[model samples]
Target: MANTSSAKKMVRKIERRTAVNKARRSRVRTYLRKVEEAIAAGDSTGAQDALKVAQSEMQRAVGHGIFHKNMASRKMSRLSGRIKAIGA
Candidate 1:
């Protein structure tokens, strides 16, 4: 469907970027899930550690433009809050 050679190249670039973004997103989700699982298991220390890793991954996602800055901040805030509430 691309009419020009440049257009075809653009399509290829988009596909490559999409795959990279998808992998990044998946990695971020895995980090978040680890935190959630730790929280569910009531291991505050493990949850805290996982939350730290998740926060780092989320920030990386924002830096890479895979997620909005505020979105990542909000998620980190909520996850931290949950981590705090776990032992209280």
Candidate 2:
């Protein structure tokens, strides 16, 4: 239990932030899934287009402190590599 009013307020604030973060995470995952689906379907052009959108969404998530910069970069790198391999 929160013993102080300040602690209660902090808990409330944390809950709100958690909800927002969850939504952002879900959005980023959705974009990433789109890219994966396009790649799996062997549509390189579509995958590239989806990757463009996913990259922006991912960068935005990183900017919002939802993902670490290096993690985002790594994910983008792997996805781009897959896209390239599909074209090859």
Give candidates' CA RMSD values in order: 0.6, 0.6
Which sections of candidate 1 miss by over 4 Å?
none
List TM-score per model, in order.
0.97, 0.97
lDDT of 2 by residue, 15-61 (tens): 99999999999999999999999999999999999999999999999
CA-lDDT, candidates in order: 0.93, 0.98
Tens-place lDDT per residue, model 1, 8-88, is 999999999999999999999999999999989988999999988888889899999999999999988898898889989
Poorest 10 consecutive residues by lDDT, candidate 2: 1-10
lDDT for model 2 comes to 0.98
Candidate 1, TM-score vs. the true structure? 0.97
Q: Estimate candidate 1's alpha-carbon lDDT, on a 0 to 1 scale.
A: 0.93
The reply for model 2, stretches above 4 Å from the true place, is none
The window of 10 residues in a row where model 1 has the poorest summed lDDT is 75-84
